[model samples]
Target: MHRAPVVLERAADREAVPDDVWVELRRAARELGFSQIGVADVDLASAEPGLLAWLQQGLHGSMLYMERHGLRRARPAELVPGTVRVITARMDYLPRATSDGWQAIAFERLHRPTEATVSLYARGRDYHKVMRARLQKLADGLAERIGPFGHRVFTDSAPVLEVELASRSGLGWRGKHTLALSREAGSMFFLGEIYVDLALPLTPASEAHCGSCRACIDVCPTQAIVSERRLDARRCISYLTIEHDGPIPEEFRAPIGNRIYGCDDCQLVCPWNKYAQRASLPDFDARDAFDAPSLLQLWAWNEDEFLRRTEGSAIRRIGFERWRRNLAVALGNAWRETGDAALSRALSEAREAASALVREHVDWALAQRDTPALEPGS
Candidate 1:
């Protein structure tokens, strides 16, 4: 069920926030594993036109919720009445165990077609659970400092323009890939917000640092980054494998490669990500099975096994059918590349029990065994 918008009545008797509140909030946020915090005023009228144009261009694909929410996303005050300032928090999500040269390691996984590559972000506990709970704690700490104030916490859960809010408040500049990028933290962090009635001072916005660098746009598997900052989600492998619910589009299947959950190619190629910070909390550590599992290993999972392994994971939200569908596509890419009879046999075995959607992809996977394997980026 969709959650009703959280609207809190502003407290008439609320105490004036202390001038040192921002300093206190940052100290508290850091203790809770947040990398940085900033405040953004609620006026986002200037962003509406570009947002409307993106929606009108159908770049968001089947994410109809983006269309439905409309300008309310830009106007945070309308979504949460009396929301004067949005407290934006950034948390670096590179797993605690991630090592130096991790981007190279991730690129290596992409080259090994038989390996099932889950995006680093989805490898551990669901970020929604981790981020929301911490953001609520941050809000609670503020309430303790300045008495009770109307506030609501959010991660990626709502229609809020998270990147816009983060960028507006100095968390980072929007990178060419359209993700918030900081010189200190790169594009590998999660962003959360606390909408409050308190009138806090706003953080100054950061200036764009990506000059003449087209790495992110140039590296997209399907060229989803249509221009510098514009992404066509329809062609994006991450969207195709996750947000997109139907059959894998034919054109993007080969380029999708072995990425079964989400794609990290754009981030991997970005020059700034060498500075990507490791997650301070253990909540994002890569689970053993997902660390570098093979296509066959993930393919063997029955619905019950899929549920068991993906418990408390964002991957579970995609459900078992989509899970198998993605695996089938990845297995197909592997089958083409390796001409591995094991991949073909695995797809054939699952064909009978699969849903019509999965079976179609399974059949496609089996058919790929005879195709010539093209080199990556060919």
Candidate 2:
């Protein structure tokens, strides 16, 4: 699937790439469902210190791969030799059927302890599949025009600093939550990159718009955002539910609430999200099952059913063990909050049949029936 790298025969060959190529690429990107596209130079040495600090602090938790990749993440040429300019793309992911006041609806779900609250981005097909295919297509279209360039496409698949490249290329600015934020598209979009040897015109970086806003930080159920742009990923709910593979930390269980997949508290509270755009492609539309699934409803699924239901979803990546583990914690929280006999019954019935990890969580959930349910965010 790899193409031979492009080689310049002479010094003049470097200038053969048309300067107006970006204008045509942007038009092709829009046709392929990307919301915006930009070009970034590959000098990311300025970002290496911050990336090193984050990793050295053990903020990445169990993701040892981050430590393994090291500075190669900051150097595109090292990862893919000959990378000079990177093409960055943004694609909005809000479900096309999303209504007005969607943030309120998200907040409402958090208050309802028995309802399963998945992050908005994961309610549809796996974005890795959706984005990777489109990105490859975008690269193919460019090859058609520019006639075979040395390039490689990436979404969240690699160690490249997505937000840094994104912001540098005028896609958006880094918001308080450390997510790339655009005035026009907000933070509810996915980012992808194509590292190419072509010396394309660089896109100007956008200015920071979050003046004094602390909504994203204050609204975090786990306070994962330690400072304006610094995040402790270990404490992030999205990381807890999706990345951390072992048992859910006891401290974050209750605050984790009914979020079985990822959390969107920060994005939900951001004022800029009021302008969040919906998906141009139907691939991001929410399935009927994930829309308003209840705790017991999801709890009823065995491994086989779990696989069948989550076949093409990002949720499937967690596998049934972690999936059940997350569900058990949410169920425990639900048992304490409502003391619903059915919730208790569901947990008890699954206890003996569950995996060791899931069984432990199930036992913890059953114990919640005795503890007083604290108020949300208390």
Candidate 3:
């Protein structure tokens, strides 16, 4: 899907700066902590079909906003008035200060099976703050470079189709795992955008490098990667544990493993992750709460403790009820694996949680421990 870079001069003219301004913008974004920056024209018609297809297939699950927005997500100008271009930016987030042995630490938690396993991304402070701040700084620098113009900035915001803009702008190609990826940086990063009124010279799209590699597909613990580049989000552990609100489906409970929060099996196992780079900023440090929590440890958290522990975290958005519900599923899986008296006691302890939702999940979990043979059917 790579396209030739449009030619333009960088003379700082009122009409539009040349393509060399792209180099300057890229340098400025990097200096502001972004890993890469690319500009894409507002026309995203190519992605409209895929957006419609994914929605029609109900792959978005309970994220009703994705369906509610309809084609506005793929059409930048419709979402934001006067947006002729999108300045897509990327920033790495592997935690620059993490010890070299961290990947091994993550894998070790999975071996225990009884301990909670959270997605690597959620262990840190909420990325929304860090990325949005730095992206504003990058935008400020752009304003200084080419003078003030009408623009709006976004990071992980619901109003935009960020991956589509990133891929079309040469930031990276969308991988088979459905993440924006680069051969140099893999998918361990955040993306932000500047919907600008001024028409900047657009960068060409990057080529897809996934080729015949199906690492993400093969690594899904719950077989959520239903096809090469398509995901059955309902079966995804991250979706079930984080985005899903109702009862954990009967068919996906055991396969969810110990992922009490978000899941990272697919991304962790991607061969391209060998090239994964660390974030220059340390905003993504692993919080101690998620390091090696046991089902018993997490199940003990009251609503007050959950609120205090997850404050300023993306995990908080799921709210305490879904949080407990997800943990209940994980605890059930843990109990099925090793019928521990403590887990049974804990499940019994939570049978009267303030929220009936938590109590219901806990009741379901206790029943799972009572019938281990029935648990494996998930």
- lDDT of predicted model 1: 0.89
Q: All candidates' lDDT scores?
A: 0.89, 0.89, 0.78
What's model 3's lDDT at 91?
85
- Candidate 1 lDDT, tens digit per residue, 56-88? 999999999999999999998888887888999
Better of 2 and 3 by TM-score: 2
Query: Which residue runs does candidate 3 get wrong by more than 4 Å?
Result: 1-14, 18-21, 99-104, 370-378
Q: Which of candidates 2 and 3 reaches a greater lDDT?
A: 2
* Comparing 1 and 3 on lDDT, the stronger one: 1
Please provide TM-scores, in order, for all candidate models, with all chains considered together.
0.97, 0.97, 0.91
Q: Which window of ten consecutive residues has the lowest lDDT sum in model 2? A: 4-13
lDDT of 2 by residue, 270-334 (tens): 99998999999999999877889998999999889999999899999999999999999999999
Cα lDDT for residue 252, candidate 3: 80
Q: What's the number of clashes in each of the models? A: 0, 0, 3
Question: What's the lDDT for residue 322 in model 2?
Answer: 96
The alpha-carbon lDDT assigned to residue 357 of candidate 1 equals 95
Question: Residue 196 of model 1: what lDDT?
Answer: 83
